[model samples]
Target: MQPLPLLSGADPTRALDAIFVNAPLRDYGQRPRTNDYTLPVLGMAYIATYSQRAGFNVAVLDAEAHGLGIVETAELVNAARPRWAAMNLLAPTYEMSARIAAHLAPDIALMVGGHHAKAMPDRILADPRMANLRTLVLGEGELRVAALLEDEQRRRELPGVLWRDPLLGTRAAGIPSGKPNPQMLGPDINALPYVNRAFLPQDPYQAAPTETDRRLARNRGTDLLKNAARTGHREANIVGSRGCPYNCTFCGAAVSANPDLSIRVRSPENIIGELDQLHAEYGVTAFRFVDDLFLGAGRVIDEQMAAFTQNRIGERYVWDATGRINVLNRLSDSELDRLVQNGLREVALGIESGSDRILKAMDKRIDAEMTERVAHRLVKHGIGVKGYFILGFPGESHDDIEATVRHIRNLWALADNSPGDIRASVFEFRPYPGTPIWTTLTDAGHSPDALLAYGDVDLTSDGADETMRQRDEFNFSVDIQFGDVPLARVRSTLATLTREQHQRNQATQGAAA
Candidate 1:
C-alpha cells in the first residue's frame, strides 16, 4: 500500500477533499512545558483512512502530536485548502479546538465531533466562537462524515448528525426528540479499515515512562536520558473495542452518558492484522490498547487471550490494556498465566475510590477488596498494575479520601514484595457534561455554563518548585470543588498522593541500584 502524502505545506493548486485536525491540548505558549509524550490521534486517522477508501482526497494535521499552537495549526489547515475541516474535541481541549476552528477559512466547512461534542452538541453549535462550524457529529463519525462529504442534499437527514436549520435554528436529525437514542448503533467495528498510520506523523510517539526506564534514569540521575529512552521506543495506541457498558458516574463514556454508543469489538484476526501492519510498517514493538473495555468479562476475555496466544502476539511484541477488577479476579490462575505468556505486560484498572460508599455512589460495582485481590493475583503473575484513583466525589467525606489513600498504600505494598510494579495515578474529580454526576449536580442547582467554563484543571501552583511543577502535567485538578471535602483539602490530598508516588519511585530506584 502506498502511503498518502501528508498535508505539511501549502499548495495553491491542489485542493483536498477533507483535512482532519487533532487540536492541541492547550495553548503551547502559555504553558511552561508540555507533556513528555503525545498520543497518536487515531480517531482522525481512522476517519481519514475510511474517507480515502471512498475516493475522497484526505489528509491529516495532528497539531497535538507536532506541538503546534492554535495559530500555527490554523495556518497549516488553511494552507491545505481543504473543502472540509474536521476536528476531534474533548472537554479539556475545547477552547483550543474552538479557537483553531475560528481561524480556518470561512468557506471551509467545519465538522466537530468527540466526547465533548457528543455530550454538548447544542452548546457547541451555539457557541459564537465556532460560528462557522457546519455540523456537530453526535456519535461515531465515520459513516456520517463520509455521507457529509459525498452528498449535500441528504446531510440534514443524516442519522447522528446535528446541523443548523435556517428557520429551525439548531436542529437534530435522526436522533430522538429529547436525548440520544440508546438503540442507535454506529458502524460495524470489524468492517472498518485498520487505522492508516500513513496519515500520522512519521516519528514514533513517545510513551509514558516504564518501570525499567525509571530505574535506569534514576541510576543515571538524569531526566533527559529517561525521556530519550521513552522516545526511542516505537509505541502505538490501538483501540480494539469501543463504548463501555458500565455507567460510572464520573465517566463521560459511560452507557448513561452516551446512550447512542453501543459496545463493539473488532475480531481477534482484525486486531492481529493491525498489529502486524504497525510492526511491519513502523517497527512499533509496544502497543497500548486505549479501549474503555478491552478486557471484558467471561467469554470476551477468554476469546481474546486465546487468539493472542495462537497468534504468538506476546512473543513478537509486548502490550498493555485496561481491565476490570471483577473480570480479572474471575480469571483462574491458568488463564492469568496464559495472558502473561501472551505478552500482557500491564493492566490499567479504574479503582476510582477506596470507600465502599463512594464506590457505590460512583456506580463502581467492585469494592476495595476486589481491587486488592486482583492486584495480588496480577502481581503474582508478574503483570504490572496501573491503578487510577479519584480523590473527591460530590458527597464524598474525609474518611472516604483516607480510605482511598490506604487503598493506594496497600496496592503499593503488594507490588513492593513482588516482581510486578504498581503505579498510582490520582486525580481530583471534575464533572463532565452528560455524565450521571453532571445530571446530579445540575439537578441540585449547579449552572451548566459555570461547570463548562471551569475548563482544564491547573495543577501547578506558585509555591511549587520546578520539580513539582514538572509533575503537574501528569496530575489534574480543578479550582472548583463540588465535593463535601474542601477544595484546599482535595488539593492537599492530591499533593500527598503525588508525593507518595514520587517517594516510592525513588525507593525503587535505590533498591535497583
Candidate 2:
C-alpha cells in the first residue's frame, strides 16, 4: 500500500515482514533546519531493539534527519511493504502521521499508540478507521510490544494495551483484549542497550559542536559518576532528575503518573562514574546535560562539587546544561563559583516571558527580575548563559508582547555589559499535545490547526517596539495576533540581525587571521 497520492501497484508481501512508521519531527511539520538529530527518540529505540531481538524484521524511516516529507516517507513504506506496523506519535501530529500510516498500511495490520492513546484510549476505539488496528499500546511500549508478540491472543492479560480483533467477522466480535502496563524506564536506561549507530547519517549534527556526539554517546549518565577517571570533556546525556514536577497552566499536567516527580538525580558520584567511562572509552572532553531543567544548583551541584573536591578531579572537565531561570536567581556566589570551578562553564535558562501578566497566565514561576538577576549572576560567575524565550500564551495581548520586547531590550543592555557572556534565543509558540496549553486551547477551541506550522512572532526583531527599550520581552511568543504590533516583522528583523551577526563574526575571524 502506498501512502497519499500513490498506492501499492506491486506485491506488498515481498517488501518486508514488519515495519513501524517512525515519525520524526519532519514527519509532522517544517522549520528552518538546524543541527541534524538522531531518529531513534531513544525511548522508541528500546522497543525497536527488543522487537528486533524477537527475530522480527524491522526498519525505521527517520524522516526528520533525512528531511523527507510525510508523503515521500509513505512512498518508501509502500515500497518496503511491511505487513504489520506498530506506530504512535503525539496527538497534535497524530492526524498526519496516522493518515500516512493508513495509506502505506492498507492491507497490513496497523497498531497506533502514544500519549494520545494513553490519554484517550476509548475515544480512539470509536473510530472505525482504527478498526483494523491490532493494538494500541499505551504508556511504556517496550514491554507491551514484547508481550503482544509473545501472546498472539492477549486482550485478556496485557495491561495498558488496547486492541481490536486480528480476525474480524470470524465470530469474535467482542473479544476482551489484553491490558499490559509497561513499567516506566529510568535510572537503568543504560542497562537497556546501545542504539544502532547505523541509523544516523554521516556525522549527525556535523555543524554542531563535538559535545553533541558526546551527549549522545558513551558518557550518557547511567548511575551518574560513571566516568570517574576522565581528565577532560566527557560527553553525556542527563538522566532526568525527578521528571518535571509542575503542570503549569500552559503545560499538560497529567502526562505522567506522578505529577510532582520533584527533580531527582543519581548521586553525583554515579554521574561522575559515567563521565569517567566516556573519557576512558571514547576520549570525550566536553559534556552537555540534556535535562529539561537543571535545578541542581544548591544540593546536587554542591554534592557534585564536594565529590570532585574529595576525589581531586577538579578542572578535568567542562559542561553545559539547561535550567530554569529561578535556579540561578537563588544561588549564592559561592555555589556559582563551585559550579564554575568544577567546569560547569555554560548554562541555558528558559525565561518564558517578560510580562508578569503573561508569565502569570502561563504559570511560569519566574519573573523578568528573576531572569535579569540570573543573567547577572551567571555573567559574574563567568558562565556563558543562553536565554530562550517564547511568545504567545493564554491571555497575552499586543501590549503584553510589547512589554515582552521591552523586557528583551532591558535584558540586552544587561547582557551587553557582559558581552559574549550571554546570548539570546527565541522560538514561536507551539502547543504540544498532553500539555495544559494544548488541552486548554483545544478545549477552548482556539488551538492552531497544525502543530507543525511555525508561528510569526520573532523576538530578535528591530521592528520590535524600539520605544520600550527597558521593556524587552525576555521569553515570550505571540500566540495571538498582536493589537498594533506587526508580527513576523520582528522575525524578518531578527533574521537580518542574525545574518549580520554571523557576517561580522566571520569578518573578525578573517581580520584576526
Candidate 3:
C-alpha cells in the first residue's frame, strides 16, 4: 500500500489487511517529537515484516517519525481503512494511546501492544476507556502477529494475544472479553525475517532542536552540532537478542509478560545479511543494537564477532550496544581489543548505583570494583562509555548517595575530568508496573497509579513547575527520594559533578583547537 498524504481526500480503494503504527506517548497533546535521540520504532517494523510475509497487505505509519500529530495520524489511518490497526505503545503514552484508539475505533478493529500492554494487560484491558481496543499482543509480537493475520477465525486462541472475544456470551460484550488471556508466545529470534525498514521514512527522523540544544550551540559554537551532524541523520537500530538473562528487580525487561527468561540470540549470518542490505541500500554505516544485554551470553558475542571478522560485517560499519559490567569484566583484553577493532565504538552500561548494598538489593550481581575496572578498560581502549545511574531506590541512604558521588567523581577523574568522551545519564527511580520492586512497593500499600503520576513530571525540562520538578531541580534528578538524604546536599554534589564535566568538555575543545 502507498503512503497516504495527511490532507489527501483520496481513500484506499480496499481496506488493507493490517496497519502498524508507532505513536508518541506525550500527554499534553502530540508534539512533533518526544525524545532527543529518535530512532525508527524497530519493533513495529518487525511486526509489519511478518504480517506482509504472511500474505497480508500491511501499511506502517511511524507517526512520530513523520512529524504527524494525533489528528493528522488519525486522518492517515482513516484513509487506509485497514481491517485492523496495531500500535506500539510505551508506559508514558498509555493514556494517549487510549485516546487514539477511541478516535479510530468502531470503524477499525484496534489492537494495542508494546511495553505498557505487556506489563499491565489486566489493568489496561479492564479499563472502560479501552473498550474499543480489540486485541493486545503480548510478549514477542512477530510470531503472534503473523498468526493473527493468517488465521482470523482463531485469533483469540493464538498465544501472546489478550484479545476481546466478544462472542462468548451475553457478558462477553464488555470486560469479560479481556478475561482469561491466551498464553504468551515463545518466538525464536533467528527465525524471524529482517525488519521491513521500507515501511519507515527514507530520510530518517531528526529531533527538532530544543532550547537546551539551541543554548549549547550558541555557547559552545558549532562543534557540538557539527559532530552530531557528521554522525548523519540516518542511523538504524537492530536487535540481535531479546530479553536479558539477569533478573534485575528494577527493570521492566526482567519481569516481562513472557514466561521465558532465556536470552534469544539471532544467528550471526542473519544479522550480517541485514547489515549488508542497510549499508548498500540506505548508505547507512552506523547502527544501534537495541538489545537489553548485548553480551548476556558470552558465546553469542564471540560467534558474532567471528562472523563479522570472517564476513567483514564490522569493517564498513560503526555501532553501539548495552552490556552488563560483569559480562564486560569477563572479556579478556585481547577479546575486547578484537571487538574495538571490529567497529565497537561505544557500549552503555547499567551501573545503577555505586553502593554495593544498593546493587545487591537491586540484584545487580556485579559490584562497584568490577564496574570501575571494566569502565576504565573500555575508556583506555578508546571506546566511549555511557554509564546509567539511578539515584533514588526506595531503600538507598545518604551514605549510599555519597558513595555514588564518589564513584562518579572517580569516573570523571579517569578522563582528567572531561565530559568529551566519558559520560553519565541519571534517572530517578520510577516504579513502573509489573517490575519486581514495583510489585513489592504496591504490596506494601503504595499506589502504583500515584507513583506513575509523579514520574510523568518532566525533570529534564527547565520550565517545569511541578512539585517533583522543583525537587528534581534541587537534586539534579527526579522526585523519588530514598532514606534520609537531604535534597540540598544531593543538589550540591550534582552541581559540583556537572561543573567538573563542563571543565572537561572545555579543556578537550581547547586541546582540539
Candidate 4:
C-alpha cells in the first residue's frame, strides 16, 4: 500500500491520537545532495505498533525518508491533526527537530524523546522553540508513551517521563534519585508486538552495500545480480535486542549513560518469527540487525544460531549484525564456522582505537591486538569484518592516530589473504551528551553549547564527496578537534583514508570488468 498521505489534511471529525515523526537530518536545499540510504524509523514503528495495539489511532511520518524539509515536515504533521506530536531527537539533528517541533500546531501536545532528549532534558525544556512540548519521554518509550496516550493526567506519575508542573516548573515523575525505577522498565522483549511496517512507505527503501560487499562483488562476481534475478534485493533493519551493557566512554547509549535502560533480548523463536514474516510479507531477503548486540555472548549466541540453522534461515536469507570483539574472540572455530554456515555475512566491531592507551581512555576493553586476532579468525571462517575506528578523542595524540592507521593497514592485508573481506570504517570523534567523555570534557570546562555548536555534519563534503552514496555506511564527525591533534591534521587523515578506500573500490571494479 502507498504510504498514508502525508500532506493531505485530516478530517475535522477524526483527529489522530498520536503521530510519531522522524525529522529530517538537515535542510536538503541548504546542502549538497547526498545519496545516503534511508531506512524506516524502527523505533517509531515499535512505539506506534504498541500504541495501536492498545486501541489508539497512531501514525508515523518519516520526514527523513521522504526528504521533507522543516516547513514541509511541519505542514505534513499539522495536516495529520494528531492530538500528540512525538518526535525523536539526536545530537546532529537537534536543530532540525526543534525547528520542526516549533512549527507544529499549538493545539498539538508535543512529546519529545530519544538519546539526546534523555541526556539533556533541561536544555530541551528550556528551548524557546519547544514551548508546546508537554512531555519529555525518557529511556525506553513504549511504556511511558502508551501510558501518557491512555491518560495525559498520569504524566507526573509515570516513570521515565518528564513534564512541566503548573506550579513547580519542570519535574520528573517516576524516576527517583537519578535511578531507573524497576517498576517502569517496560515488558519482556519477547512480549512486545512486532513492529508494524505497514505504516512505512510501500516503495522499497535503498540499502547501500558495505565496503566488504563491494570488494567481494568485485572479486567473486556480483551477488546483487543473482539476487535481482531471483527474489530481488529487498532489505530491512531488524532488532533482536536492546540496550548495551558496556560502558564505552564515547557512546551515548552506554549502560552507565542510560541507567534507565535495561539490556534485553528476544527469544530465538521470536526473532525467527519476525524474519519469516518480513521475508513473506515484504520480500526482505537481506536483514541487518540494528541491535546493540544481536546474539549476545556465551551460550546466547549458540542458542540463537542453532535456532537459525534449524529453521534453515541461512539457506533462505543472508544477514549481517553487530558483535563485541572480545565475545567473538572467545567463540571456538567451530562456532565461527556455524555462524558462516548460518548466513552471517559481516560483523560490525567497535574497535574504537588501535592504541592501547586510547582504548583504555575510551573504556573499550579490547585492544588493537585482540581486534586483529578477531578479524583474522572471522575472515578465515568466510565471514567479513567491518572494523569501526574513532580518531581525535579528547586527549588523543598524534602517535595514537598513527597507530590506528597502521592497524587499518594490517586488517586490510589480513583480508587480502583470507577468503572473506574487511572494511575500515573510520571517523573523527565528537563528544555526545551523557557519555563518559562528555562529562569529562564538561568537567574540564568545555561548555555544552560550544561543544554542541558544531551543527549537522555535511557528509557529502569533508573529502567524502566521491563516496556520498556510501555516506550512510559510516558516521560523519563534526571535524572539530577535541584532542591533541590539530583539526587540519584530523581532516587530512580522514580524507586520505576515505580517498584510499574509494580508489581501492574503483580499482577492484576495473579489475572485475
Candidate 5:
C-alpha cells in the first residue's frame, strides 16, 4: 500500500538475491504497453513471494505500471545490485526484454521466462542481444528460482533451465545450446506462498474497459456508479489453476510451453486462504481469476464452488474468470447455477469464432453448437458472458469473417435476460513466435521472428512498419475491419447492436425496479 522503501535504496545489509520485473512494453500508438489491461504481473509477484519465503531477499518491480522507461528501470536494478534480475516475457516485449537484458546483464545474472521465453527458449537464448542473459527459466519459475538461489551452480543443472552452455568457449564452433535439463516441477502450488499483493505500489490499476464491460454497464449487470468507490481499493488477480487441457492454436500457455497440456489446480482451501489474506489486509473486494481455465468437470470445480458458497467468500466479493465453453458444458446445471448465484458475475469464454471451420483450424475442439449452448446457458443462469473472437489468421477469408460476425449476432440474440448481458470482442490475430499458427506459418517458410522483430505485426510502427500496417492496422479493439468486410457496414452493425442492447438493458432495469 505504501511506496516501496526499496526503491529509495536497497538495505545495504540485506543480501538481495534477485529482483523480478514486469518489463514495460513498448507504446503502441495511443495504447501504452502494459501487462494486459493494467493488471499486475502475478507471475513475477509469485516468484518474488516464493523467493522471499525461500530465504532470499527479493523485490518485485512493475515498470509499465510505474511508467519507468528502460533506462530508469535499469538504473533501479543496478542500484539494488541484485545477484540476479529476472523479467517475465511477452512477445510484444521481446525488444524491450533484449534491451533491458543488455543493460542489466554482465553485472547481474539476467533471466527471462513467461510465455515468450517458454515458447521459444532456443531463439531467446540464442539471440545475440540476449548475450548477457545468463539463463532462461522455462515453464514455472517458483521452484527453479529458489533452487538457483540456494545453489548458484544449479542454473546449468536444473531441468526447465536453459543456460548458455559452459563447455563451449566464448567463440562458439557453432551455436550455443540453450536447452534445459530434465528436472522436477516445483512443489505443489498449494504449498507456495500467496502472491505478495501488499508489496505492490499503491497506485490502482484497471484494464481498459472491454466492449463487454461497456455493454454490461448499459445492461445494468455491472454497477457503473459503485465502480468509482471501488476504483482505489485493491483490485487483485489470483490463479486457482494453471494450464488448460485444450490445444488452441493461438494459445502460448501449456499447449505451447508445457506440451502435455496437463492442468493443475490449487486446493480450494489454498485459494480461499489467499483471498482471505487479500481481503483482510488490502480490502481487495473485487478480484479476477487469472487461471487459463477456471472451471472444469470434476472434484476441483465442486470443491471450489462449495468453498466459495459455504465459506461465504463469494458473498464478500464479486469476481470473474476464463473458461472453455466445453468445460463449462461439463458442469451440471445445478453446478453452473451455484456459481452464478454466488459471486461468479462474469466469465470470458474462448469462443474464438462462430465458423466451425475456423474453430477447427484454431483447434478449439468445441464447435458452433457447443459455443452457442454454453453461452445461452450462462446467460439463462444470470452470468454475464464475454465472447472472444479473432480475425486475420493466415488463410482467413471473407466468408470466415462473416461467419464469426454471424456467431456474434447469434450470441447477442440468445441472451434474453438483458441488453449488454452478452457481448463479443474481436481481436486481430498476431502469430506470436511459438503458437501453433506461428509454427504453421514458419514451417511454410514465413519467418515470424523476423516479421515481429521488424515491427511488422506489432502495434508500434515505423516507416518499415508499413507492410504490417497495410496488412491491417492490427488493432485489438477490432475497430478496424481488416478485410472485405465493409467498414461502414461493420460500424453500422456495431451501432445497431449497441442500440438494441441499450434498449433491452433499460427494459430489464425498469422491470426489476
Candidate 6:
C-alpha cells in the first residue's frame, strides 16, 4: 500500500519515444475549467496502444488527474524527457496547456488536442500569446500520432498538417475532419488493438460504486480505473458516437473543422464486434465513450438500440457513458430493461443546479422537476445516476442558493439504503472560454478564472484572496432549506456557491494591480 515512487529524483527514461502529459489546475475556482479531466487519458492511452502495437516504448503523465501542479508536472515531464510530448485540452486548461507547451518547448515536440483544438484549431494552432507548439493533430490525434510515427513516408507525406506557419500565420487547406483513410475508418476500434491493460488507475471507481455487496468490475468486470493504474497498460478510448443533438446552451459542439454536423452513431455491431476481439485478443475492457450525448440523437436512437440488440453481448462486460435525461426518458420499459440486461452501470447527468433560475441561465432546458423525475427514474431502474449540479452563474441571488440546497436534500432523501436509491455527486461552476456564458459571466463581474481556477491568492481587501482559496476547497458544513418546508422541501444550508464566486471576482477585480 505504499505510494507509487515518484522517481525521488529526475529519471530520464520516463520519456522514451513518446510522453503523454495531462496539465495541472493552477487555479481551483470551486471547479476549475478542466473540461475533460474526469475523462481518463483515453487519447494518450490510444497513442499508448498504437505505440505498443508498433513495438515502441510509451508512458502516460496524468498531471491533472494526479493533482500535480504545473511546475510539478513540468518536473515530471522534464524527467521523462520524451522526444515527443503531447497534452490534452478542454477550455479550462487552454492557457495552462499553452504555458506547458511553452515550458517544454524548443526541444519537445509538444502537441495538444481536445474541445479547444476541435472548436478552434486555427486559433489555437496559430496562437501567438502562449508558446509555440510542434503540430496540432487536425482531427483524431490517436491515428494521426500513430501514423506520423509508424510510417516515415506517410507521416511526412500525410494529408493533414495542423501546425503553425510563421510566414503565413497558420497552416491551411489540409485534411478535413471527414477525409478518412481506409486503414483507420471510424477507428477500426477493433483492429487498433487495446493498450497494455497495465496502466489504468487503481480502484478509480471506488468513489462511484452503487451495489453495497457488488464486487469491482474484475469480480465481474475489468474497468478503466484498474487498467489505468498499471505501470505499462496501453489503452485507447472509443467514442461510440459524437455530437449532441439536444440544445443545452452550456455544452459546446465538438472539435474545430469537424465536418460532421450530426452526431455519428457506431453500430453496436461496430463496437461489440471489435470489442469482442478487443477483449479476446487484447484483454481490453476499460472503455470511456466520448459522445457529448452517447446513444442516438433524437429519432435514430432506434438504430443504435437495434445495433446493441443484434450485437449485444448478453453479459460479463461493461462501459461508462453520458446520457441526456430526456434521451433516457425516451426509452420504453423494454429498452430500459435491455440497458439493465446489458451492463449500463453508470450514467452522468448535468443536473447542474437545483435552482430553476440557474438552470434557465445555463439554458439547461431541463427544469429541476424534470431533473428529479429523470434521476428518480434512473435509480429505480438500478442505473447508477450521478447527478452533476453546479453553483454560481450571473443572476443567481441568495435565494437561488437555497433552491440548490433543496435540490440536494431532495436527492439525499431519495437515497434510502434501508430499501431505496443511494448514489450522487455535486460540482460548482466556473465559466469556460469560447462558451456564451463565459463572456456573459465575465461581463457580469463573476469570472473566477482570474483568481479561482488557477493557484495563487490575491491578498487585497477583506482577505478576498483567502476567501477565494476557501471557495476552491469550500464544502457545505451547515444545514439550509428551500420551498416552505418538509414534504415539498429539499435540503438545508447548502448554497449553490456561485454568487460568492462573483464576490471573489470583485475582490480580484478590485485588487488588480
Q: Candidate 5 has which clashing residue pairs, if any?
A: 159-181, 159-183
User: What stretches of model 3 exceed 4 Å from their correct place?
Assistant: 1-3, 6-14, 28-36, 66-69, 165-184, 202-234, 255-257, 417-420, 458-483, 486-513
After superposition, candidate 5 runs with Cα above 4 Å error? 1-15, 27-37, 166-184, 202-234, 254-257, 260-262, 416-420, 454-513
lDDT, each prediction: 0.76, 0.54, 0.66, 0.77, 0.66, 0.53
**What is candidate 3's local distance difference test score?**
0.66
Residue pairs that clash (backbone atoms under 3 angstroms), model 3: 25-93, 418-504
The Cα error of candidate 3 at residue 278, in Å, is 0.7
Clash pairs, model 1 backbone:
none
TM-score of 2: 0.70
Q: For residues 1-513, what per-residue lDDT tens digits would candidate 2 score against the true structure?
A: 333222111223334445556554434334433333442344455466666666554555555445566677777777666666666666544555666665665776676776666655665665555556767765556655765655545635655456654455221222334532224322244344443333223211212232222222233232222343222233444443435555455454332432423345656666677667655655555566766544534566566678866754544566677776665677788877777666665687767678888777677777878878888877665576767666555466677766767776676566554522555565455565556766667777654444424333334445444322222222234245422444454345344434433444345335433
**Candidate closest to the true structure, highest TM-score:** 4
Candidate 6 lDDT over residue span 1-513, tens digit each: 122233221133433666667665452323353233354655566667676566555667766556556655666667565677766776656666776666664566666666567556766776664445656664455677766555433443444546665577756433534655644323545455544434433212333222321322223333443433232222234556645555454455523223444345655566676567656765544444656656535454566556655665434345556777667766777777676556565676777777887787666667888877766766666665556665444456668766776776686556432222334444334444545654555576654435224332222333233333433332321121112332111212222233343443344335432
Look at candidate 3 and tell me the lDDT of residue 488: 48
Q: Write the per-residue lDDT of candidate 5 for residues 202-255, one digit (tens) a residue.
A: 322444344334433343343431452334225677788877666678777635
Quote the lDDT for 410 in model 3. Answer: 84
C-alpha RMSD of each candidate structure in angstroms? 5.1, 8.3, 6.5, 3.7, 6.6, 10.4
Which clashing pairs does model 4 show? none
What TM-score quantifies how close candidate 1 is to the native fold? Answer: 0.88
> Which tens-of-lDDT digit does each residue in 82-133 have in candidate 4?
8999989988788888999889899999999998998999889889899888
Q: After superposition, how far is residue 218 of candidate 6 from its true place, in Å?
A: 19
